[model samples]
Target: MRVLFTVYPNSLAHLYPVVPLAWALQSAGHEVRIAAHHSSAELITKTGLTPVLLGDPDQPPVRLTDDCAPPHHQDIVNRYADVMGLSPEGREHWIVFYQWLMQPTSDYVRLDRSEAEDLIEFARVWKPDLISWDATIPAAAVAAKVCGAAHTRLLIGHDMFGWSLDRLAENESALKAAGLDPNPLATLIRPLAAKYGYEVDDELLVGQWSIETMLEGLRLPTSTKKLPMRHVPYVDPEPFPKWLYERPEATRCECCGRKNRRRVALSLGESTRRFIKGDWDRAPKIIKALGELDDLEIVATLDKAQLADVEEIPPNVKVIDWVNLPHLLPTCSALIHHGGIGTYSSAVAHKVPQLVCDVEGVSLLMRLVEDGDVNKTGTYRLGWEFDEREEGAPDAATAHWELPAKKVESTVVSDFVISTGAGVRLDHRATTVEEIRDLVWSVATNPCYRHAAAALHDDWLAMPSPSDVIPDLEKLVVQHRR
Candidate 1:
């Protein structure tokens, strides 16, 4: 079979999930190549996969946008929430964060007619047997329908897209039962499908079948044909220098070979330093505070902007710009990071406890925040909560003064910390440096969180490997072929 893998091209986090499957299919004697926008060309090439670049790098990855997102994007989530009777906090979480995480498939953002036209042109020429896309890039569905290829959605994190679409259908059914006109999510979903002369259905977003790496018990509810694949932690294939593999105290006495007083991994994601124009760059402050933990060794990954602000590098803390997380995480007792799928998945694979500081930059939607001073521009739950004076809102039932405390701990917070049962969530706004120091020390010293993380890792390890699913995927291609 000839397979075409498609993605929105902005995030490697989204792209990596599909690579293992691609490799599995390729090794099984199928032809495989990745199709993405030009921005992702270098990364895809480095992975040693063939790439079909869809558009010029000069244009915005998604061609059309307004002051914020295109109107219909919000319409999809809004209609789903309204028909489902979701609470305001629920609505905001879906709209501002969860829905935004599905960026590649952001109908208005990723699917202008031009990108669709480009994809279909390639599909017509390539004549692939299957077209598998990352969860958000609905344009691939259009290309598949036009070119007569079978397709599937390869998921990166939670199936929030599938879960939301399922609720949309159920809610519409309930609305119909009550004699109210159904709020058709299809309104926002159908433009591209209709443009290609097909009506929308569950497969438009979720695909004919889908592949997910998250553990079964932790998945959001979905009605799609979902399959589990054991997550193989994706890392740089190039070998690391020998020094990184040695434990800090590997040279200690032979009797005990005493560990270096428990090592902790401290890494705030790229967004923490660059997002919000640097207002939430907590790396320096956090490192300085964690430095106070005299008995522990800290390995922190920080950016140049964050490195500039620190007056002293603590004896117990090591600050470098970057290290492969797969290499760093397993050596550590715990992780402190932005709640990205990459870090969370790595932590899960290594059975390391985490401290999710805040979730920003995962989504692109902005909301009218009534309590924060920004009111109109705070992009995600963590973006606005950094404001010290934000007041809790009764109408929304979100923390005003203490967002992590008041609101439902934001989408990414629950996804990374609470849902996984691996670590504590902090309202970073209310959590002081000393408090963070204490919390990090406790999570690192305590064994309960590690036990929970281990159980979750065990479940993940029990799932089928990518090669194990190749036969299933081949069978699906034969069944779903146009």
Candidate 2:
């Protein structure tokens, strides 16, 4: 059977999750091709899969405007929250973040009509047996429908999109009462679907089913039938640097005396490293403060761009541009990182304790931008708390005073870490360097964190690996394909 894979071309983060499974299908003698924007052709080739380019490499990237997003996005979010009966804090944790997330899939932003037509034309010519796409790409669903192919979303994290669509369906009466269409996903896809001479439907929007890498415990409340698989970490292959294997103690007399010192992997995750320009002011501060510990060696996976603000490199810290997490994580005592699924899953797979930091503030600002407040921006700071007793709302203490305390993905992962006793979640935006130092030390030295991490590792190991789940995927394709 021929299988076609598709993902949004915005980043490799979306592409990486599906590679292992694509490889698994290929190993089982199926033909597989990855279709993405032309910009990602090189990356697709790097994964050892055939590439199907969908759009012109020179085309300006698709973008959404503020005028197009806010009102409709907020309405859908509010309705979904109402149907879910979320609490105030629950709304903050997920719904608010999702409102900001809705921009990407909004009516404004999507694959160019020409690019999408390109995909549909390819599907027609290729007649793929199945189309597995990133959850963010609804146009692939349209192509699958037009081509009579089975389709499923390949989720890298939580199933927020699926969950929202499910909520809308389950509360059809309430939505109708409110004078709204229950199937917002279908509504969003209608313009494109109509072009293909088909009416929009749930199967095209949500897929016949989905494949997810998140453990069952981390899953959201969604009615979509999903198959769970263990996340296999894959990075663009890089040659090992000679210094990586050499023990630091051999080169410096100072390191030889601190035999008790532990090694910690410090990274801001790929999204931050690739997308965030300039250093996050907090990165240098955290590295320097953690470096002050006499009993630690910090391996910071950061490039020169991220370290531009640092006046001095700490003697105990080794800053490198890149190192594969699967290679370096096993040697580390703990991980301190932005809560990207790639980094979080790598640490869990390697049984390393973790300290996950703030990701919500940026999402909060995203809400402001979508609401047409583009000029309102602030430097993200750590360590503020609101006194509940004094609240209606607090006055601005600094630039962009109201920062979100949580982002949906980070909060979910961090909560699981805390619940399992495997790590700590640094929730405060205003957390001090001293506080971070203590948290890092606690998770690294505490055997409880190690035991908890091992337990989590055992759970992760129990999930079916890519190669192990090949039969299930084949069965599903057989069952769902026309």
Candidate 3:
């Protein structure tokens, strides 16, 4: 069977997962082609797939330029800037930020439509058996509908788009424009059947649409009569550090190759960029705390701007501009991160304890730690808290104190310290340069965290392969043809 895989172009996240699935289909003796933004053509080609460029070459890139203060400092300006110009007002400031957040997908949707028009022109000449699309690609469903082909959504992280459609029934207008209804399952399956001029039984659509509903509906196995749905497919690169396999037996740190070296991985998501940029002063304090540690090597994944603000590169720290984290995280001791779904899943896949720094919304980190027996496995929890000072409480003390004591909270503080578990709860108030030094020494000298980390690593390595969870792709092709 011949298949056309579609993705949104902007960054590596949308492209990476689709590659392996395309490769898997190709390896199964199916012809596969990929369509994406021109910027990502090289990356798609690197995956050994043919690239179909999606947008006009002369079109300008979507620029998210705004005049307000950076995100970290938004709270400071937002409090007083209400009296300022319209651009600086708190309400207007958030509107700009929200627009920036949606810019990538919004821009890609325009390109997807342009690309789909081209694909429709192409399909009139060369037909494909099926069309598999990344969740971000807005046009693939429509293209499949117009071309009369099977359509399937290949998820990378959580199904954000599908979830949004379900949560905000207000998206009915957008769905209608895309030829879908408010019903997610029908929104997905009906288009393909209509395009193909075939009568699809509701049962087959339900069975095939399991991946979409299982995740979006938030229905766990015990709560529903439906069979457990397969997890999203991920291609794990091999030749991983042997310690990941030998875990409890390999009593040494994988990165430093030292039994004395304490291992921890810091996975920075997009939210970290927002918080760090908003509060520029906190960078120095974070650096000072990191610098004091001799035994601790802070492996931080940061964006270009965040890396620029980091003045001194301490010997104990390794900064990677970008990396394949899903490949690198399994060998780490613990993870410190902003709680994005990708980072969360990587930590879970490795079974490593996590320190989540939630900068917005209700504290997801606290909820997870409180609900689960995380302390037993050594997961730590901490978050930035904010309380508006009434009148004149105190002037800003230092970079550390500028955040104020009321602005930070920990749910499982004592459990982290006394439990001898796999995680450490770094108190934002007390985590001074000197304390960070001592904690690093303790983690390096102690054996408990490493022991637990290794045990968890081995268990993850023993789980069923991601490929095994789904029906064979070869079988899907045969069934579709029949």
Best by TM-score: 2
- Which segments of candidate 3 are over 4 A away from where they belong? 60-104, 108-113, 123-125, 168-259, 270-283, 326-331, 360-466, 469-482
Give the per-residue lDDT digits (tens) of candidate 3, residues 5-99: 77766445556656655676677677889887566677777766898776565542232212111222434323322322223222332322222
Candidate 1 versus the native: TM-score?
Answer: 0.80
List TM-scores for all candidates, in order.
0.80, 0.84, 0.58
Model 1 alpha-carbon drift over 4 Å, by segment: 63-83, 87-93, 96-113, 173-185, 249-259, 271-274, 279-281, 305-312, 358-365, 368-421
Off by over 4 Å in 2: 63-85, 89-98, 106-112, 179-181, 247-258, 273-275, 278-281, 308-311, 359-365, 369-408, 428-430
Best by lDDT: 2
Task: Give the lowest summed-lDDT range of ten residues in model 2.
Answer: 380-389
> What is the lDDT for 192 in model 1?
69
**Residues 28-54 of candidate 2: C-alpha lDDT, one tens digit per residue:** 999999987776788888878888887
The sequence of per-residue lDDT tens digits that candidate 1 reaches over residues 1-482 is: 99999876655666776778888888899999898877678888877788888775676455222222322244455665676787654565556334455432453323443566677789989889999987656777777877778898887776767766655566766767655445334545577677677887666766888887777665666788887887776754667856468765433435777644778898766443432323243555677778898777888887665565567789888887778888888778899876666777788889999887664323334333435543222233321222221424222323111112111223455454667678976436666889888998888878988998898788878899899998888888888887
**Poorest stretch of ten by lDDT in candidate 1:** 399-408
- After superposition of all CA atoms, the RMSD between model 2 and the true structure is 7.2
- Computed on alpha carbons, the lDDT of every model, listed in order, comes to 0.67, 0.71, 0.46
lDDT of 1: 0.67
The deviation in Å at residue 468 for candidate 1 is: 1.3
